[model samples]
Target: MPAVSAVSAAPLPAPPRTLGTGLLLVVLVVAFEAMAVGTVLPRVASELQGLSLYGWASSAFLLSSLFGAVLGGVLSDRRGLAWGAGFSLAVFAAGLLVGGLAPTMLVFVLGRLIQGLGAGGLGALPFAVVTAHYPEAQRARMLAAVASAWLLPALVGPLVASLIADTWSWRAVFWGLVPLLALIAPLCLWPLRGPAPRVGEGSGGAGLLRPALGLALAAGALVEGLRSPGPLGAGLVGLGGAGVVLTARHLFPAGLLRFAGGLPTALAVRGLAAFALLGANSFLPLALHELRGLSLTAAGWVLSLGGATWTLGSWAQAQAERRWGPGSRPLRVRVGLGLMATGLLASALAVLGGLPLWAVYPSWVLACFGMGVGYNSNSLYALAAAPPGESGRLSGQLANIEVLMVAVAAGVGGALIARLPLERAFALAFAVTLLAAVLGWLAAGRLRRTS
Candidate 1:
């Protein structure tokens, strides 16, 4: 009887369908807004006669979202994912409504600030949900799916927004998303209902808020400073830079600036990757339009194509992980960063050298692809390394840092463009991105230690 016994391996649990659907919906909505907003902002400014506060519309959302990210992380850890998500979504919806109904630019900026609070939390909450709900084996696919959600929006959001604004009104862009949010809210929340299981002790409290506020203020000052001219701009820059340095310690993991090994380094690399890719991307359209004599439409197409390729790269990493195991992450990061650097260099040549206009397409594609691969890899590493109960905090930090770096990169690049000639400004901007990518590549080895 004993000799007749048989052993069978248990099958892995299937992925969470509702959770996946809800997350994808969230990503889709957010991505669409991100893609479409720029198209309609000009209209918003003109209609409101808020050209002077134009930059603040974007800056207010960004800075407020930084605070939201921290607050959401704390809520997720303490209150549970469902509570945090619901609260964030409600805030976001309210902001949309306010923006849609806004009569003045001041009112609209207020709405944007409100939206940023919710949006930041929304951005951070997904990582906590995935970490808490999805099985370890399935995380890669889920992340890849999230990346894929951006593809549709990336492809059509701008064009659709433009059409909507042309046919209806720019406010329609804000109003349209409300119904979609209503539909998605239940799907996401129903599954997440009830208290989140405590994986570890809750960490951040109201104590962290001061530093978060400081960080947000610092970012705002820096951007405004970059936009300003002369002594006042320099003073603002110095103050903002000082504030960031002083406050960052409270928000980021220890040794982040020094690139301490493991999780800290991984987080640093993520920030650097964003700095390199997004900074370059922020200016790519301008470069193509001004330098290469491409029409705005043609330049937009290049961005859309780059976005699609980035999704492809994300999927590629997921598949690679499935075949080769999680151990492949460090190599993926390194290769991705290296490719990004190469692409930036190519873009510089295409714009500055005698290369044909067509050259920019391939170069931008390469850089975006690298971003897709490396960015996801860094995320996986950070999430994996997060201590129990700390996923939300870490994820929020991740979002916060990326946002901060991007703001800095864009601000610096914009400042250069404002002061220098077009060619020289672009050259310096590309140089900054290139330098970031190279530093990221050099630091990527630390990710292996965490692995």
Candidate 2:
């Protein structure tokens, strides 16, 4: 509502030529791998006889990515965005190889950890690219373009993986991604080849290296602690929580834990949405199959459909921003979070009450759509809030928080599903996520106050 200043306003930039296309390509490969993995993870679990560790398969990626994101951010700040982005892609490709050939669940998890590291890095650096290259005015549309990249993959990834899983082997899904990564990595890194952002003399981007590792440990401990029962579990949980709080304080913006106003609140909503939506998403396939009696293919379709709608919401937001201007962000974020909360609540109700199966599909679409809109808005808000020269670090911090909470949510939710009855476990999981969504909705209120 206040007058926008030149420093903060998203001035129009030269029209993006190849930069946007290359970045979208990068996103597509990563997204395909992710969506494909989800499609076959159940099969992977069954084949490996590691059904109990199903959540870890996904959590391991998220856990390691937390450190990867921080490392990437620092490296980008200290060196260049291209350097960070390239490194993450190489690491990600190797992870696919490792995962494709994994002989057991332990090995598979290791591969996931490696892949996550790259994903975290790749995830953060793109924002840096946008920050450095695009004007704030073009950011929304640019971000929407990035979101749209996921459309094709979302529409086909699951089906492709399912077909591969059914006809050939799950390993093919992993192996197949390797070559594509090889092709796209260079293109993705090309636009980033120029002067990098300047880091302050004493900012010591390198200094945070140790803290990144510490954050990863804390993440793992939190997941492990939640999974474990009894005194030992409680102790691990406590230790992990403490580590998270301590390490996060350094890695994230100040006052994140206290839900500090402005950028802090925006970051909170991002993490909370990940915690709420992805936590449930991680297990939704399992729930669909176990509780609702849907087949694996059917479950995969639900995920694909949800992804498409998420993209739709993202595009819709982009259009609104283009037409209505930046003033629309707060309203868009509020609407997105509200939809997310509503969707989560609706799903929980359907699951808990044993309603008709058809109801779940629409509920999920709403939730994903909410995420598409809110998550994208949060990125713009966070980037906008960054002080001059802090965009990369802030983006990394946001990514780190999002991945960390998702890891925790999935880890804890998976553990619950393993131990409890299907109905009760899902109910509790949805409830926890519902709580997270509500928290995010509350957090959205502060977005306009930032910067």
lDDT of each: 0.85, 0.82
Residues 1-451 of candidate 1 have per-residue lDDT tens digits of 0111011123335645887898789889988988898999999999999998898898899889998998888777777888778888988888888988899999999989998998998988777777777766677788888889999999999999999999999998997899999999988888877766474544665667789999999988988899789999999999999999888989998889988877788889998988999888899889888988889999989889889988988998888878976777888999988888888899788988667667888998998898888888878777777677677787789889988998999899999999999999999999998999999999998765332
Model 1 TM-score relative to the real fold: 0.95
Mark the regions of model 2 whose C-alpha exceeds 4 Å error after superposition. 1-16, 42-55, 103-105, 165-169, 201-204, 449-451
lDDT tens digits, residues 1-451, model 2? 3322222445546745777777888898888897789778988888898887777787789888888988888888777778888888889989999999998988999999999999998888767778777886788888888888889988888788889989999999998888877777676677678786678553458778788889999989988988888999899999998998888877776777767767777788889998998888888888888887889778878878888888888888888778877766777888898998998788766656666788888999999998888888777777776665666677688788888888889778977887898888988898899999999888788667332
Give the winner by TM-score: 1
Worst 10 residues of 2 by lDDT: 1-10
